[model samples]
Target: MRLNYPFFFIFFLFFINSTYSYSADCEKPIMPSDAEWNSWIQDIKEEAYTEGISKKTINQELDLITPQKKIILRDRCQPESQITFDEYLYYRVDKSRIMSGKNMMKKYKNELELVANHFNIQPRFIVAVLGLESFYGKNQGKIKTMEAVGTLAYDRRRSNFYKKQLFAALKIIDMNLVESKSLIGSWGGAIGAVQMIPTTYLESGYDFDGDDKIDIWNNYLDIFASVANYLTSIDKNPWSSDSTWGREVIPPNNIKDIYDSLKQIDPKGCGAVKRRSVPKKLSEWKKLGFKKINGDPLPIRDDLEARLVAPDGIDGSKFYLVYPNYKNILYYNCSSYYALSIGILSDEIIK
Candidate 1:
């Protein structure tokens, strides 16, 4: 999801791609020479074989790999990278998507409840992620997984990170989890209904149906369970089913300076938005005049800590007091806009 392009270059490419279109002949604008590309593949093959990938897989999958110009272009032109929070929410959490998610939850109620109970994750959260990632498997992407990962591995900007993913993808093929030819995903190598990267799939995938294979692409049970397992996985920040992601609130005018002074720049890869103040007990925020948008008192739980986030700046119409569960959603996708959309969409589905 995160590629290490220089920040300025990313904005420059976005600007150029938005302003103009390349002709078909100019589509592949940049590529290494054949000799150079072949040598890189040879090196990858050697490393793959030494790591225990079968010779057949190495020869069949790696030999035919070529730079996927389309993937590089897609990576550089992500609309979500440039859109406003309101625009992002409108596009991703529309009425149609909410309706589809509701139907999906109703149709799969028994299975969803089973997985939710087993994993202690909310069913709505799982369904929301499914809807956001692939429209409930209706658009699981069309690019070949190996080809996409291989192309990024050779692109040089984030080669080392993507090379590791390429290896993980080959191991998936070697284990017969999915055939090399049938393995498909997004331009960045995220796969299946949940759009997990190869490393995430290997780490948290579950065979919920007990068929002995984790088929996130085709099996609804496995897909749901795998998603739940991932959020609850030990390697991730812990998710608390006891808390909601966040609540909309109104801050008192007298507290403006305190809130403004608390703002901080988000770490790289977190998102472009400014982060909120460091967390404090919910009780403390209540004493400072934060209240629910409905004018109710803030929750009186002494054990809970939260941060105030106003995505469009302090004067923005939307303001939220977010909890740890909100941060957990960020692990699934780093963007605050992305996490907020998921939370709002999940709430709509539950309603």
Candidate 2:
């Protein structure tokens, strides 16, 4: 029943079909006419009513909704979609972010430990995710959640997905989880310090601080606990407290051949999971010439399996051998670039 989905799916889902840009020569895209927009709003209201949202809430919240051009444009031109893996990592996991993450770790040492102990997630990782998502609560976006999600739901690209998110946002308001006036978040409708989409918040958010409200926006305790809880929400590969996310690996000279031979298809999960190589035991990978980034031998563990992920490709200078815990992080954001940044940041901040 949890509707929380990998946020990266939205980026990939939209980018899969077309790439939009803001160049001067680029033709301006068409917007829906008022009449068209109104009809869609009417249909959405009926659907919301059918979905069991109170008539009062629907009438108050959806009456004046309109498609937002800014939200549509923001969705179309995310920087991660266009950048190289190195470039993306460089910006996402920079020195400033690392230092801030460390400070946050110290500042919330006690609270983080409690959340970590309760949820069995690494404290540094919780810090890393929040740091990346909203700069440790300093910048959790200001766009009105209803308006942003409504716009996305109306847009042709990823309409079904956003429609679900829009309704989830409404449900939150109807449940009195967060008031309509204060329901603000990212252009993509991701709320709070951890940048959870409405569906994710509804499903995984917790009132850890016991304030009677799950305030991921301002409460650090709730934010930390919510993140830890969400990370461990994956049932098949629940986070392993005994293991770390993954490490950078030095691949064999014939990594391309090795990659082709070892690659296996995943029919389930998002497109990101499908792009990674099949999981192989650490021992098997070691025998095939995979080593620690520092040229050390991989841990002698035949029991553990890891998947080789080269976001840039075999030609890229860096490669990672990701463990199951990495997939847990992927539940938050499906992209390897995003997950790797969290992994590396988690290590750096703790050091």
Winning model by lDDT: 2
The digit string of per-residue lDDT tens for model 2 on 1-351 reads: 222322343444444536644434233447899899889988999999988999899889998577788778766654333566776666668899899998998888999999999999889989999877877888777889999999988886879999999899999999888878878887888888888888889889988977778889888899999999989988888898999989998998887776777767544777567767888899988999999999999888988989988888778878999999998888888877888888999999988
Q: After superposition, how far is residue 21 of candidate 2 from its true place, in Å?
A: 4.9
In order of listing, the candidates' clash counts read 0, 0
TM-score per candidate, chains pooled: 0.87, 0.88
Clashing pairs for model 2 are none
Question: Which of the numbered candidates is closest to the native, going by highest TM-score?
Answer: 2
Poorest lDDT segment (10 consecutive residues) of candidate 1 = 1-10
lDDT of each: 0.79, 0.82
Candidate 1, residue 239: the lDDT equals 84
Query: Lowest summed-lDDT stretch of 10 residues in model 2?
Result: 1-10
lDDT tens digits by residue: candidate 1, 48-157: 88888898988888987899777776665443344456765776788999999999999999999999999998999999988877788777777898999999899876
